[model samples]
Target: MAFDAVVTDLDGTVVRADGTVSAATLQAAHALSAAGVPLLAATARTPTGVAALTTLAPHLAFAVCCSGAVGWVPGAPEPAWCELLPRAEVADLVAFLTRELPTVALAAYDSRRWRMTATYQAMRPNTHKGPITVVEAAALPEAEACTLVLGHPDRTPEQLVAALIEGGFDPTRLGLHRAGRRFVEVTAAPIDKASGVLRALRVVGADPARTIAFGDMPIDTTMFAVVGRSVAMAGAPPEVLAAATDHTASVEDDGFARALTALL
Candidate 1:
């Protein structure tokens, strides 16, 4: 396919294990952009996290943030588009989660800032680098939010997801997916990486059949489904690997850079 756009996940696809973008990956991104291919970072990260990526790759003008609830362009002040959960629903979910998983930590984010419950800060120290307001769970403001994160250091993501389902979180009303081994992200229903990719395509005027996507997690599945070429990283979970059209080397092996080199 004569791909004109590239979308990649951040943590395990393009960014290295130590939370740095490799030189090769950056070069590949530059090469793609120089060749007229738009590069987008599709991730579950909030705008704060997306900022770090945009700083690294200025050519990357677009990002799918908050799993898919927000589409951001750095320096734009506001997102290109945003989807927010209802205030009442946010309050109800907070109350429900607190009742069911009292020990779990919770963090909520809008487009700009994060409000982390005291328990979440205690559970995952130094997880977020940007300014975070520590608040009580019961005091969590009833307001529009882009994403809510449930963190449990001891439980697997699958277990956490099951727990949320058991807590009466209707899938039709929300998007629930594991972002990592211990984090399950909650967003507005029908929002995900694929939806974000679609938004990016609209902004960039790229055809779905002419877009290439790369990811290494289950959250990336929707993005894979939307693109013509889906490349999963080596050593990804079996389900993620199965969801992709092809497999590439692991991030540690510079798989992302290699794949881009071959494609661009």
Candidate 2:
């Protein structure tokens, strides 16, 4: 196979539910390094969240964080690049959401700290980093941020996205992705895993057509469409599986290692 580069999703792919990387995966990572293939990560997680994967840090050359809105080198203090939400556009979106989803709570990640509505605090409770600032809903739109968080107490993330679309919310100007725990992440328009992966590829001098990706979520589908080869975990949903060029065992079964081993 001889892939030039490998980009993988963290959770549900290489990282397990309990946040551990299997020994086989580590061995495969070392194998990739030995073969001179740079390993990259594209995740919907914030840099802080990605930092939790301490064991996998040494394997990654770069991490595409915040669903492509931000890029970071594993232990870097700042992002390589970050795209923030347009203030006026955010205000307009907030106004629209207020009318369409009255119960929806809003939060902003300004690349520094999170400023969230009290309602968001109640709903997400203790999940955010410390010094979380509870602010009024109206103030959230004014906060400078690379990503926005939208959630509802009554509606699932999927339902919330559906409701927004049905209400004529234009997602084209912004990126919206369903994330863990009943929330949707919104980033600046045109920001996605593919864009971030391309950034890393450019720096690594890897041919995009020779890059292989591994993932198990819908978020990974975008990356799948751009990369040369895409390997979906066996237990992934049908759409994720459909988007991939190959299939591997589940994460618990060391699917990431199995795929990389085969490719090498």
Candidate 3:
């Protein structure tokens, strides 16, 4: 089947563990570009994070970052748009989550910069890098955020989300989804990867039904629903795999390149 565009998640879908793209993956991306199929990224990463993907950015026509809260052009100075969580809602969500999970750590991304609690700062490994401003926990809700990350040392992101729901944490006007294994990310409601993909497709006049997507996370399910084909990585969780329309090898084996070769 022919596709007009390609949308992929970054971390586990295309990028290797060492944070680099394989030569085969690069060749496939170049092939897509040469064929006029723009490769776009829909990920939970911020603009900085997306920018850090230098090896892949040259092949990307557009990037939907912060789990779809911000849109970016490959080398543009500013984001196309940044959707921020309402400050009041942030306050309410933070208060509720803190009470429910006392050990939880909070971090907020305000499009350009990150405002996080000292506890969260300490929790981050030295390898985890970003533009961060360590602030008091109470100061977190004061700034509107593009994405708010909530993490607990013990619980997995899926478990954290389940606990939040069970504890009656209202998600009204907010998008709450898991990121990686440790954090639950929050963004404005109705602005997810699907929305971001649609926005990017609009720029190039591509149809959602002709766009193929690749991802390996639960948050990516929304993109899967909107795209013509959704290829889940082999290493993805059972639920994520089940949500996809197709499956590919694991990233360790250049799964994205293999899938693109087969699909195109």
lDDT of 2 by residue, 1-264 (tens): 478899999888998887789999998988888878899999877777777777888888888988899898888898888899999878877887888778789888877678888788888776665347888778887788899889988888888888777766578887888766478988887888888899888988888899999999887899999999999998898999999999999999999998877766
What stretches of model 2 exceed 4 Å from their correct place?
A: 125-131
Pairs clashing within candidate 2? none
TM-score of 3: 0.95
lDDT of 2: 0.85
- lDDT per residue as tens, model 3, 1-264: 399899999998898888888999989999998888888999988878877878888898999998899999988988999998888888888888787778789999887788887778778654244677888777888887888998998888878877777766656667888888778888888888989899989997889999999999888999999998899999898989999999999999999999987876
- Superposed Cα deviation of residue 237, candidate 1 (Å): 0.3
Least accurate 10 contiguous residues by lDDT in model 3: 122-131
Please give the CA lDDT of all the candidate structures: 0.83, 0.85, 0.86
* True-vs-predicted CA distance for residue 134, candidate 1, Å: 0.3
Error of 1 at 100 (Å): 1.7
Error of 3 at 237 (Å): 1.0
Report model 1's TM-score to 2 decimal places: 0.95
Please write out the lDDT profile of model 1 over residues 27-120, one tens digit for every residue. 8878777788888889887767767765354868688888888988866778888898877878888888778777878888877678888888
> lDDT score of model 3?
0.86
Model 3 misplacement above 4 A: 126-130
